[model samples]
Target: MSQLERADRILDTAQDLLLRWGYRRVTIDEIAKRAGVGKGTVYLHWRTRDELFLAVGAREAVAMIEAVAAAMRADPAEIALHAYMRRFFLEAMRRPVLRALFTRDTDTLDRFLSSPARQPLQGAKLLASREYLGALADHGLLREDLRPEDLDYSLPTIAFGFFAIEPLLPKELALGLEEKADQLADVLRRTYGPARPPSPARLAAAAPEVVEIFERLAREYGAVAYGTTKGGDPEHGS
Candidate 1:
């Protein structure tokens, strides 16, 4: 098999083991065994167990970002702040690894939570960046009164609550994932969206820019996940 294909197979095996056994219990020996490669081969791809798991986390982040970008490309209306939040929430819910990262599931992630790799994976910061929010504001999708600083704090706090709160409620009382996502979209719309909707022309004009921002994020995360660069701002390869 090609080297790239072998690396992906190893990653696939590692991610499966991580989801099934959690980080604390999964080991390199098992990952190599399952991937049909020697333990040394796994090391060749990822020098340490922590790096391997971090790559898994980064890969999941890339998938979620790409999914959100895809939705925006397919529908210009999805470029609006509220629509983006809805799509992001649903995408996170659909990926167990990504969901764990968002919810801070320590049982699954443990010490990996504190890894520097976690920084770029925080989609909240990327999504709420001045550039991203400014684009929304320019398109009249964001409320005129909202500042970029306000979003930097509010978006992550609000998204965190949604990710962290669901598991705390009783199963019988908890809302389904789709319903919760809708509620999240509603809250974001009421809190950040303009009182008057932007025209379709504005949304269409904004789609390429909004989608490009997310696509860039995906590339950064993909670099970290695939070991093209060490952890830290993937843009500079730091």
Candidate 2:
């Protein structure tokens, strides 16, 4: 198989192992064996076990970026902060990888995700999401008086709070994921929405650029996770 294909195979195996056995238990040799490659072959794709898992996380990030992009492309209204958050949360909840990253459940991949080296990429992704809010503000789709720093802190706190707390509640008391997301979206809109929403034309124009910014950052994350320079081709990377 080609290098890229092997890399993908390794990543797939790693993710499976990670979900089945938390980060501390999964070993590079096992991933290699599952992928039908020698242990050294895994090192060619990712220099360390942490890097390999980060790459798995990065792949999840890419999926999220694409989901957001697709949502915006499908509905111009999604460029609005509320709609975007609703879609993003629902998508994140649906994907196991993303759910693991967002909620950081101990029974899941929390140990790997909370690593010191992983902090930078996690912080960068948060910053990029904040930038998306800024993009909407720039287009006048958000409140005029909103401060960037406040936004940088607020939205994530709210989203993270929901993810962190929801599972602790009794299932009978807990709302379905979609229902909760819709409520969260409404709350964000009421709190941050512009006095008058932006025109569809404005939203359409802004969405792609914002999505592109996220996509670029996600690629940088993948590069970092795989121990390669940003924008490096998967096929060619060591």
TM-scores of all models? Answer: 0.89, 0.88
What residue runs in model 2 are displaced by over 4 Å at the alpha carbon? 225-238
Q: What lDDT score is found at residue 31 in candidate 2?
A: 87
Backbone collisions counted per model: 0, 0
CA lDDT of each candidate? 0.80, 0.77
Per-residue alpha-carbon lDDT of candidate 1 for residues 61-165, written as tens digits (9 for 90 to 100): 788988888888888999887788888889887888888878888888887888865665565445536778888887778898877667887887896798898
How far out, in Å, is residue 35 in model 1?
1.1
Q: How much does each candidate deviate from the true structure in C-alpha RMSD?
A: 5.3, 3.6
TM-score for model 2?
0.88
Scored by lDDT, model 1 comes in at 0.80
Candidate 1 lowest-lDDT run of ten: 229-238
